[model samples]
Target chain A: MALGLAALLFIVLCALPVFYMLGVSLVGADGAFSLNHYFRLFAEVRQLDLFLNSLLLATATSLLATAIGAPLGVLLARADLPAKRALRILLIIPLAVPPYVMGLAWIYMGSDSGIIAQATGRDFLSPLTYSLTGAVIVLSVSFYPLAMLAAEAAARGVDARMEEAALLVAAPRRVLWRITLPIAAPSIAAAALLIFVLALSEFGVPGLLRVPVFTTEVFTAFSALYDFGAATALAVPLLALALMAGITARFMIGERLLVGRRGARNRSPLSLNSRRAGLAVTIALALFVLLPIAALALETGRAERMILALRSSVEAITNSLTLAFVGATMAALIGLLLGYARARMHRFAGTVDLAMIVAFAAPGTVIGVGLIGLWNRPGLMEEIYRSRLIILIAYLARLIPVAALILAAGARQVPASFEEAGEVAGAKWTRVFARITVPQMRAGIIAAWVVSFILAFGELGATVLVAPPGQATLPAHIYTLIANAPSGEVAALALTQSAVVMTLLALFAVFVFREKRLHS
Target chain B: MNDSFLRLVNIVKRFGRREVVRNLSLEAAEGEVVALLGPSGCGKTTVLRVIAGLEAPDEGEVWIAGRKVASDGINIEGPRARHVGFVFQDLALWPHMTVAGNLDFALASVSVARRERAARITEALRMARIESFASSYPDQLSGGEQQRAALARAIVSRPGLLLLDEPMSSLDTELKGELIGEIAALQRSLQVTTVYITHDRAEAAALAHRVAILREGRIERIDEIASL
Candidate 1:
């Protein structure tokens, strides 16, 4: 019964945001339900342009992220890369850096007095950080890890014996094209779709780069215009696109990759012999990964100037941490219960999992819009929205799906028989869960906790739209700091944010590694 | 003997449209080792689980040590109340548990004193020839050792009827032969009624006093090793 309640809690947490958006999208300034807002969205060419810009940006980011990520995935999974373990770790750290921080780092490099501008003598804003192309570059860098992780996992799933068979009959290129790529297609498509959804919902890069995508327009409507109805209406297209992409990604990646065998840990790393290949990968890493980080670090040295520039970064850090803790705690509790239910009660698992993912795929702006639409009415919920409770609810809405997915992955490894064995031995279901199930899934629980925490900490899209007056999160604060401060201070503050995020992520990675060692 | 220990009457289980265990009925005497032998997917494991109450039959009844655990008209008890011990094919030994923890979990409801529980764990480890490895995790142990740990865990509760579901499938050829004799010896010494399921005919013939071969969810024959 407790498990059931937990599932209901998570499901409601996910649904309320989307429904709230839907309610607000339909309601008008006159406080009556109407279709005029949506009609206005289609009829206005500028609004339509914003929609197109977001769509095109999402498509480009997906392609670019996939193109960059797929080869590296193949290298990591199939080829022998130098310092492979260190490289894998480095690749994942980018994910830990919040998208807004990445934007600030780019701004520091590309701005008029930016380090890159000083060093290269090229106008920083000439072609990047202030245009549509700049948005794509930033979004791709932020989201490529999605493609990298998924493609690598899929590459690992291909039987080495099949590759051997292909090698026996043909050249390496033919074998790769004919057998390996085809086999890894589902995962590749899944990765692309994931990147697409991420790009569609992205607010920070486009906002920082001064591009007016749909998310930005929504933010503008809420913050500047205070037109909650228009903001809610603007998010409808993004939500629909994300939902469609998420569904297709699910179908393409189906149940085949769901159950990973224990033997997957034994994958043999492929060797790369060409020096040119090594040079290419190193150069790519240098340009895309190292450059941004170097710029952020250089900017950090001018700490006094940065401190003078942005006052809100420090307070935003505290608020971000609080919301992150709340979101992580709620997600972990809800995730554990839902994972338990799905593992034990087989009947409703698919439906529950789908509901959670649907909630995740819905854009944060939509959620913010939804919350305002639903609770701005005079009622008990209205009071809750006026407080800190609604912000936490937004975090749950965005994070539960990720927590559930990671936990579910961990829960799958635990054989149902363990629980059955415990029950038959005379323990109650709750006792069995506590004594047997929880211990076995400790690593997964930790991973879920960290994932939700990091995602929550960096969360900006929904917070930007819905954060009550005087309430600013870390990312939102850092963002405002960049615009409000001079180049040196912006750079310094961005560096501090990066350091804190990297430290937390490193600690999480270490914990996960220890858990793996404990289990293995 | 002892009110038929554990019994099943006309158990029917279906997956969507296909019946996996069709009108299957079986019983365990007080201390008999009745091996449910069958080809892959013939529903032998399903029968073992039905008795242990891990599964509920669509259209019949299961009585565990004289208590009605499940029936067509009513479901009386869950797996916990059945007082049954099952050794899964996967050896689903809790990977997080040490050998001692595995045994302690099984013996939780036995009403044994704390000291008695500790003593029973030591005895179970000794009986399974895994005493030296009691502190180790399941993954750290060899396949044969894990099999032994699973058996020790199942038997620690002193269940009236024990179910072994392809318990030796994970072991190597050499360990399989060695452990078969050890398991048979433990069964004889403890005199626990056993329903051992296996697709391996040799294992069924070697470990079972009476082997019942099931084909396509129905029992084809029950015979002694010499007769086979």
Candidate 2:
């Protein structure tokens, strides 16, 4: 019953704003329901351009990320490379860096007086540096780690004997092409679709790169132009696209969405020979990992300026950290209940998962517009909407589905008999869940909390749209600061934000390692 | 006066200090069926892998069809270059491929002409009695049909040597007996040196000219099944 209520509360909190905005979009000036907004959207060439831009950007990002990530995943999982742990650590750190910050770093690297210009005395890439192509490149570098992780898991999941069987009659290359890659196709393609959804839903990269995508248009209509009707209408197409992509990705992955690769230690017969693959891997790491962070540092220049900028932005930093803490706690509690319920459910589970995927994929601009429409009017909700709690609401709306999915994967590992034993001891359902299940899922809960914190810390799309006056979160504030603040200060804040996120991730890893040690 | 088509000269293999195949030596004559019978984990399969060039021995030499393919610490030739047909215990049929496609891939590696490749695949599928399921993926086929397709793929290349590692382990008693008979007849007609590894003594006795008993990574004895 408690778990049911958790799911119910999440649905009600999330559905109301979205449905409100959706309903508002359907109403014409006469306030009667109609499809005129959609009609107008299709009739306008500008709207069509928006759709094409988003589609092309998403496709390019998906393709490029996969092109880089799939081969890298294969090497990491199958090769006998030296110092793999360090390499993985380096590769994964990019995942924690927000794409908008990477866009800034790239800007500093490729601008007229930027790093490349200083080094080579010319800006050869200046023209392509802040265009649609730039957005695709930034988003790919930011998102390829997702594909890499998925491909690595899928590669590891293959049984060694499968490849060995193919090897007997075919060359190694043939065996790889026919046997290994085919087995990992579902995972690779699913990851590509996921990247597509994330790219379509993204706001920061396009906004930073000066691309006129739907998300930017929605922000313009609502925040800048004060045209609520146009904002909701603009959000409709992106909402549909995100939902379609999310559902397609979910189906492509199927039941294994929550099930990761089984044995990561399984060895393949194929060996990584010579230093050629090693040289290529080194160049990739340098391109993806080292270059961006180094650019941020080069732009920031010194520790003293970063510290000074950090001091001046103390309010924004505190607001971000405090709200994210509370928001992540709420997300964890809700995710745990929903995840346990989803894991134990027998029917309608797929439907619930579909709903979660759709909610998670809904564009942040759409969610922000929906929240304003639902709660900006005079009421008790208005009180919450005026305070920092509204920001928490935005975070929960964005993050709970992802947290629940993570927890659900963890919950599935536990045996049913363990819960039954708790019930057999005369414990109530809630008690049985707490003592028998939650204890077993401690690592998952901590992990979900950490992810929630990072996402909330870096959140800008909805947060920018919904953040109360004088209470701007750090991410939203840095974005606003970029327009007027000194270049050093903005770069400093971006670096600080990245540093805080990495520190949190590092702490979480340590805690998880300690928990594993204690358990074993 | 010898007909040793597949030879292993005192091969030693280990998995991180746990010795799996210790100074193992065996030879199969041309058109001969030698079954390596042992308990599970006794490294019978490892020896077959060594001969197939899928694995290199730690301390010995392997010669297939009178060419040294592997020696201590090095493999001179890969499995495909050695022209070996191997049937894994789990069948390992390509799940994405049709039954005919599986056979075609094996034949394709040998650079067979496309026109002749179809006929060879059809002939192999027909010999294995799975010609009806030529268009079906591995998962779509019944267990017995899948077993037949595995056999078809292994021999579709007409390899100089064949290795079978308990290909009928998952089938029931009747299916197993039928497959055993089919395999024996297929081997005789193909006239290729074959090595069959299994834990079942009865299977060894039924399908092999000679059965070699293995215990603790060492060969206990080798004798004709009739003599045993």
Q: Which candidate is the best by DockQ?
A: 2
Model 1 ranges with Cα > 4 A deviation: A28-33, A256-270, A274-277, A306-313, A343-350, A377-383, B1-228
lDDT of 2: 0.86
Predicted model 1 interface RMSD: 21.6
* Model 2: per-residue Cα lDDT over A93-142, one tens digit each: 67777788888888888888777788789888789887999999999998
List per-prediction Cα lDDT, in the order shown: 0.76, 0.86
Fnat for the candidates in order: 0.00, 0.78
Rate residue B125 of model 1 by lDDT: 95
Candidate 1 is scored at a TM of: 0.67
Which candidate leads in TM-score? 2
RMSD of each candidate relative to the true structure: 20.4, 2.1
Candidate 2: CAPRI quality band: medium
Clashing pairs in 2: none
**Chain A TM-score (model 2):** 0.96
Q: Ten consecutive residues with minimal summed lDDT in candidate 2 chain A? A: A265-274
